[model samples]
Target: MTSSVFITGATSGFGEACARRFAREGWSLIISGRREDRLQALAKELSSQTEVLPIVLDVRDRAAVTRAVDNLPAKFDKLTALINNAGLALGADPAQNCDLDDWDTMVDTNIKGLMYCTRLLLPRLIAQGRGASILNLGSVAGQWPYPGSHVYGATKAFVEQFSLSLRCDLQGTGVRVSNIEPGLCESEFSLVRFGGDQARYDKTYAGAEALQPEDIAETIWWMINQPAHININSLEIMPVSQAWAGFSVHRKE
Candidate 1:
């Protein structure tokens, strides 16, 4: 049977890259995103490589997510992998200065959205058996604290904990669960975080030699292809130029 992978946020960034990567392997693709035009364009482009099902969906919408998953076609019903990649970080402001709406968006997308997909798809994945996997797109912000991380980081922290805990609950099941924490990636993600400030986006990656969507895609590819007996609990990736900031000290005048 041909393997099928359902990827959320397939319009751009790591999600899009993963869709391309899996399609190249001839895996049936169920790609979902909020942008209908972009999703359709991607499906058209990848149709030549493999079977593609483009779903115009906002992961934050529970009813919509339910409809999409519940109504999967027979051909796409047996899923081999699920890449929960529909997430975003808005603003680079401290908690006190941050907008409450931004926090809510982050929670809805990064935390709740991921939860909905994972919960809804677990049965299919479990039925698919040993080689099935769940790959969550987490961030270094979840592991390390920074000035402007705030709610974005907290939501990712939820992802990390949820992945680990879910693994425990799924111990008997052969389905694998992994959370990938990435640092300093250059993609449209930065643009969204910066509120579509092109200058800020450009400046963020100007000379950082940051990780790209393809890099994360490659990591995910390796992870899902691992042997059924081997479960990679978690993986953290950072570009060479990126590292932990030692500490912050305040000097009062």
Candidate 2:
């Protein structure tokens, strides 16, 4: 039986890259995103290589998430992997200056949405036994914080800890949990964070060799393709151009 993988936020970036990568390897995919057109386009493009089920879903919507999972078709019901890639960081402003609404949006989608999907899918993954895995997309911001990270960093910190806790809970169930934290990836992430400002996005990545979405997709594939007996606990990847920043010091005027 061809293994099936369910990927959230599949319209673009890492999620989209994962969908394509897995499809090329002949894995059936259940891809979900808010943009119906983009999802459909991806499904169409990958249909020739592998089966694709496009779900127009916003992970932030709890009811919709539940319904989408509950209504999965019989063919795609045997899920072998769940890629929790539906998350974003909004605004580069400091906490006091940040928009409260953006904070709420990030919390809802990044934290709560991930919890809902993982909770709903655990049983199916367990049923599939040893080969099952859950790959979460975290960030370097979660580990090393910077000024503008704020709530976005907080959300990823939750994800990292959550993945660790989940690994403990799933110990004997033969289910694997891996948190994939990446640094300075070039994607729609900056664009979304800066609220569609092309200039800001360009400036963020200007003249830097950053990690690409395909790089992340390849990393995930490597993790999942590991021997069933070998479970990767967590992976933190960063490009050569990026590194830890020195602590900020306030100077006396």
Candidate 3:
């Protein structure tokens, strides 16, 4: 039987990649995103291989979240996994000079949004009582605090702790919690962080190779597809060319 996956932030980056990868593996997908166009496009792209359901939602909306999950299609009610990949980095500026709106966006989307979705969807997984998984996307920034990534890093750090704690709490319930942290990933993260600053986005990975969305998605797939006895507690992935947080190399002339 094919497993079903419910994923937030499924329109782009790691979320989109995971949607495609899992579809290729014959998993039915429940994909949610803020952009209707992107969500529709993704659904169309994956419909050929696997069953795809696209939901236009903003994870920050608690009421909407509750309503959406409440109204899930019959097939999605049988979800085997939930991927909390719908978060964003607002600004990479020091706290003192940081934009309050940016900080709020980070906290709202990265932390509260995740809690809201997980809170609503966890009961379904628990009731299934077989084997289930939750994969949260974190970042190396969570481990290494840089000058301009104060709140962004803190958010991911919370994910790490939350995942560990949830795993222990769900031990007897047959549900596994895993956190995947990617360093220097190639994605819209930079554009979103800089508010669509083309120059800054261009320079983020100018001279070096970075982890691609596929790489992160593959890590998520592996964790979800693990043997029954094995649970991937935590995973941190960085491209071979990228060493660590804030350690990217520039072209030397």
Candidate 4:
């Protein structure tokens, strides 16, 4: 039987790239996103290569997520992997100056959303009786902090810890969980973080070489393709052009 993978946030960026990558490898896909048109377009594009099911989903909605997963078509019921790639970072202001709504949104989608999908799909994955995987998209922000990354980093920190705890819980079940943490990737990330300001987004990546969506997608593909006995717990990646930020000291004026 051909394997099937369900990926959230498939409208663009890493999720869309992953869908394309997996499709090219002959894996049937269930792709979900908030944008119906983009999801439909992606599904249509990938259908010729492999089976595609496009779902309009807002991971923040628990009931909706449950329904979407529970009602999977018979052919796509046995999912081999669930890629939790539906998350974002909003605003670049310091924590003290950050908007409360932005903080809530990050927590809702990044933490709560991931929990709902993982909780719902885990049973099916375990019951498959074959090796399966959960690939989470975490970030270097989770590990290293920046001035404006307070809530965004906190949410991802939860992801990293959660992924580890999951590995512990799923032990001996042949269900692997891996967190892919990336740094300085160029995508809709900056745009979303800056609230769709084209100038701000452009300035962020200007003259800087950064990782692409395909890079992370390929990493995920490699993780899933690994032998069942060899489980990769977590992988962190960053472009050579980027490195850790230096410490800041306040000088007396």
Model 2 steric clash pairs: none
Q: Candidate order by lDDT, highest to lowest?
A: 1, 2, 4, 3
Q: At residue 213, give the lDDT of candidate 4.
A: 96
RMSD of 3: 3.7
TM-score of every prediction relative to native: 0.99, 0.98, 0.94, 0.98
- Over 1-253, each residue of candidate 3 has an lDDT whose tens digit, in order, gives 5788999999899999999999999998999999999999999989999899899999999999999999997666656999999999987776899888888888999999999999899988886656788899888888887778799999999999999999878888888888998888879978888899999898998977887899888889989988766788888888788764457677989
Ten-residue segment with the worst summed lDDT in candidate 1?
A: 70-79
lDDT, model 2, position 64: 93
User: How would you encode candidate 2's per-residue C-alpha lDDT over 1-253 as one tens digit per residue?
Assistant: 9999999999999999999999999999999999999999999999999988899999988899999989998775567999999999999988999899999999999999999999988888998888899999999888889989989999999999999999899999888999999999999988999999999999889988999999999999999989888888889999999888788999999
Residue 233 in candidate 4, Cα distance off native in Å: 0.8
Question: How big is the RMSD of model 2?
Answer: 0.7
The C-alpha RMSD in Å for every predicted model, in order, reads 0.7, 0.7, 3.7, 0.9
Residue 175, model 4, lDDT: 91
Clashing pairs in 3: none
Reference-based lDDT, each prediction: 0.94, 0.93, 0.89, 0.92
